[model samples]
Target: MAALHELPSQMRAVYLREYNKPYELVTVDVPNIRENELLVEVHAAGFCHSDLQVIHGQFGTKLPIIPSHEPAGVIVQIGSKCSGPWKVGDRVGVLNFKNACAKCVGCSLSQKRYRNLDPRFCDNRETAGFQHDGAFAQYLAADPATTVLLPSSLSFEQAAPLMCAGATVWGALEKATSGLEPGATVAIVGIGGLGHLGVQFAKALGFTTIALDSRQAGRDLATEVPGGLGPDLVLDSTASDAAEKVLAFTKGEGVAAAVVCTDSIVANTWTLRLLRVGGVMVPLGLPPDRWQFDADVLVFRELVIRGSYVSSAESTRRMMEAVGRSGVRSHITTVELDDVPGIVDMYQEKNFRGRLVVKMRD
Candidate 1:
């Protein structure tokens, strides 16, 4: 066991005591560092829509859990068994997925190289914030393997979103367009946190980027990208001819691929029509209800539909490097810890712009 700190024994944390309830700030025992874990003094944590899902009892997670999964912090202490490439004071971002049974086939395969026969094979996997304590608190015990060391150039607030949202989009894009040639027409549907990052990434990768969203604000933000690359076209999905508009923008041949970043079934349905023959649509959002698509359209066009889950730690690191080097970054608004509950309510009402980060310390 490590020696106890002579300083404060209790720390402030945002915790939920029950389902469908707001997170409350309370003093709890500082978490103990495990042999493979590092004690991270959390600086900032990003609030994701999935966090709202967990809070609302939609994801089947247990009650009385810490909410934030996108956490970035400084390592205050390291465990006895910890070694190599990390030390005290390292700035890092923590991922939500933790230890898996190494004996399992999925675990044995590296994330970049593995191909599982079944998508549901890893269904029983454990995750932080869902199976273990998460970052909505002042301190988090993060597995060193799951932590991505952030460059000193990135601030904690900026790095927090990369832990989850940034990595997710990056990973999805990598998978969806692995063999994509330069100048391929790519459409990003939604233009929220993940979609916004997806647009920037697609543009950076030399694709002809198009932004699709229903809101004027989203289109406005997408158009303001530096150097005016600003989406080759911005289509307002709310318009009656959204699919036609997209097809027209692609010169009636349709986009080479589309990444569905929203959970809306309507958006998914419309996006399918905007893909050329053999084009792919990668679905990243988790919608509540089931959706259906025309079988003939899929069969005749030979269009591919796939779903992408959260990204791996290695990809997460690459995402951070990409963010550090490019002008593309998440637009975040900082909020204090005490204001999280209210923010959650506002998020439910869909009232905020960009991503929200909880500042754990002054």
Candidate 2:
């Protein structure tokens, strides 16, 4: 790998110069790679809703920042003090969270209890495209610890969405089905970017997967899963008695769990009714606000309700392995770097479906 100092001083990047405005293509200084960091030549970056949130100031982001989180690339340069087996020319997937202070209490617990909890201990923590420059650029500097080495067979475009969307659903599924036996039944609510991937992951884990979406279009797209491992049933939530339809599909036993991937409180509230006794409902998507439910439902059903954030590097690796074993493909539409602004507009209008990948490398 080339040394970091040997790289050029500036590179092309997409920046959100102002909130609620379009991202502009501009040349910015190549990030100064830390001793333990690698300068990656970004190949592909996935367009996530969170990026739009940051762009619109929904997340109170600092302006003049790059707006992207799901990035995959090749190591073009390694910092001087960097160590480990990784070398230049290695393809890698980037994690959103940057560096975690190893000495903090949370970091200790994260390392001892669960490495995925490391974000809690992240002191110099900078989420890509938010506090720091993200992968909507030609080059990105990332710590080796947070970057996962991708297999040679995995393309950068394929690995991009897995970094975020795949990890989010994978983590939620892991939490939802921790004690679940093989062949358990699971339902995924809202078959969008996260839900579509969630369906495949659930089925890969040996669950009877059911997908629920608002539109017949989404249902049609989800029903075409590879090898007929598609959803056992696809239902439109717009239809009357949607919850009853789910119950009917489950033979009246209800699903062992339902993953809510929509940021709709109504959807989350109703999805709880679809869970059987002792069933879990894990929310990965952000709702408008704290959800309110009837106390009777919670007490009578003894349902397990929880929220899952992005997964850690370990869980991400597990997700990647699952995708590798299952040969799952991301149904992505490729757009050039210049199209980011227009795509962001489409996203704000909620007009696109499936996952969108920005091809930074042309």
Which candidate has the top score in TM-score?
2
Model 1 clashes, total count: 0
User: CA lDDT of 284 in candidate 2?
Assistant: 76
Q: Against the hidden reference, what TM-scores do the models get?
A: 0.91, 0.93
In model 2, pairs of residues that clash are none
lDDT of 1 by residue, 1-362 (tens): 23334435678988877777778888888887778678889999999988877877777877677778899988887888874567777889988876554556665454435542221124445476765678988988887777889977888998898888888888888877879888999999988878888888888778898899998877777776556346888889889987787778778989988998898998898888888999999988777788777788899999999777777776777777776667676778899987887877666555455688999989
Could you tell me which 10 consecutive residues in candidate 2 have the lowest summed lDDT?
115-124
Candidates in order: C-alpha RMSD to true structure = 3.0, 2.1
Candidate 2 structure quality by residue, lDDT tens digits, 6-25: 67878888888888777888
Clashes of each: 0, 0
Off by over 4 Å in 1: 1-8, 108-125, 224-229
lDDT of each: 0.79, 0.82
